[model samples]
Target: MATIAIVYHSGYGHTAKVAEHVRSGLEAAGAQAKLYTVDAFVDAETGPWDELAAADGIIFGSPTYMGSTSAAMAKFLELTSKAWFTDGWKDKIAAGFTTSGSLAGDKNETLQRFATLASQHAMIWVNFGAKPGYSMSNSDFATVLNRAGHFLGLATQSLNDLPPEQAPDAADLQTAEVFGQRVAEATKRWVRGAA
Candidate 1:
């Protein structure tokens, strides 16, 4: 089975919730999924480097802050320079996801940041693959997936005032599942092809 590592930083729990759903999707698709907070890899000398290195794919997640990735995620990205120097993650499948308060919260930029990180590490970046779920006037927000219309990766929205439990709704979580399944399947294929 393909092993995927979901490395994420959730400031208020919403992103973590999404990551869990993503994990479920990965497992459903017959892949082994592991979740790791950015803190796990922040300390270079004592990090879970072996676990990540063994992963066939990696999915990055973070709460969008100031129209980009959070400060914590940025720091984590910088720390990955060690892996970059060693080509540790080369040829692995990589993808990303993010959440924000607004429906159109410049979230694509954050995914772009992640894809760039994957590119730097020579990883194969995977797009979200799901089409926009709210493209038509008849579509209902409550039932639609990929509501934010982002193709780079999973983009979810939550109200700033609402707690994580109430925001990011069922639809966004379901979309996250789709994202996870796609990545897992892609990783499986890539791994087999490489073998």
Candidate 2:
């Protein structure tokens, strides 16, 4: 079975919701999924490197702040420099998801940062891979699974001041769930091929 690690930093808890949906999807797809909060790792003793090294895929998530990933996520990335040198994450499937306050919060920048990080580690990046559920002219964002129609990665827009428990909406969360499942399926195939 393929194992995926969902690592994220959620400032206002919005990103955490998204990460959980991804985990659900992974588990539903029969792949083992582990959740690792960056802040938790920093505050406690989490041997994240060992988990990451054993994972067949890694899904990174964070909330967009100042048009980029929060400093917390950035710090986590920086801490992985040792893994970079050792290529500990090399060949692992990688994907990213991000939540922002605005519909278009330059969230792509954050996803691109994820892609770049994955590339530097010689890992393969996976796209969101779901068909768009609505057109631009549609007014019901709630009906579309991928409301933002993101192609590179999953992008979710949550209200700026609202609590995450009420923000991601059913559609965005469902999209994340599907995105997670896709990554798991891809990782399963990748691992089988590697073996």
Candidate 3:
């Protein structure tokens, strides 16, 4: 079975909710997916570094803050220096997800950071294949597809004013679920082909 590690930092639990939806898709796709919070790892308490190292694929996630990734995600990325130097994640499959307040809160920048980091590690980047959902026109009601229309990675939107528990919305989380399933299937194909 393929193993996927979800390393993320959710400042207000919105991202965490998205992560679970991703896990649902991953599990449905037949891969075992695990979640690792960057904060937990920071305290030297939780997180399975070994699982991360052994994972067939890794999905990086974080909230977009100040037109970039969150500080916690930044710190987590910084901690990967040892792995980067050793090419620990070389050739592994990598994807990214991000949550932001505005419909377009420069969340693409956050996804770009993840892709850049994957490139530096010599990892393969997975692109989001969904089209933009519900444009400026509310009558469109385009929500089943990629809501943000990000081709590089998954970009989810959450209302900043609402509670984190109810903000990501069903549509945003469903988009994430599709992204997760896509990655899982891709990983399975790559693994089986290599075998």
Per-model TM-score versus the true fold: 0.97, 0.94, 0.92
Pairs with backbone N, CA or C atoms under 3 Å apart (clashes), candidate 1 = none
- For model 2, how does the per-residue alpha-carbon lDDT over 1-195 read when each residue is reduced to its tens digit? 899999999977999999999999999998999999886556323556787888899999999999999999998988877788888899999999999999889999999999999999999999999767876687688768887867889999899888988989888999888998899999999999999
Q: Which candidate comes out best when scored by TM-score?
A: 1
* TM-score of candidate 2 against the unseen true structure: 0.94
Which ranges in model 3 have alpha carbons more than 4 Å from their true place?
A: 43-47, 134-139
**lDDT against the true structure, each candidate:** 0.93, 0.89, 0.86
Better of 1 and 3 by lDDT: 1
Residues 136-194, model 3: lDDT tens digits? 66534335567677889988888889887787887888888899999999999988988
The TM-score of predicted model 3 comes to: 0.92
Clashes of each: 0, 0, 0
Residue lDDT tens for model 1, 39-82: 88757667898899899999999999999999999999998888
Winning model by lDDT: 1
RMSD of 2: 1.9
lDDT of 1 at 72: 96
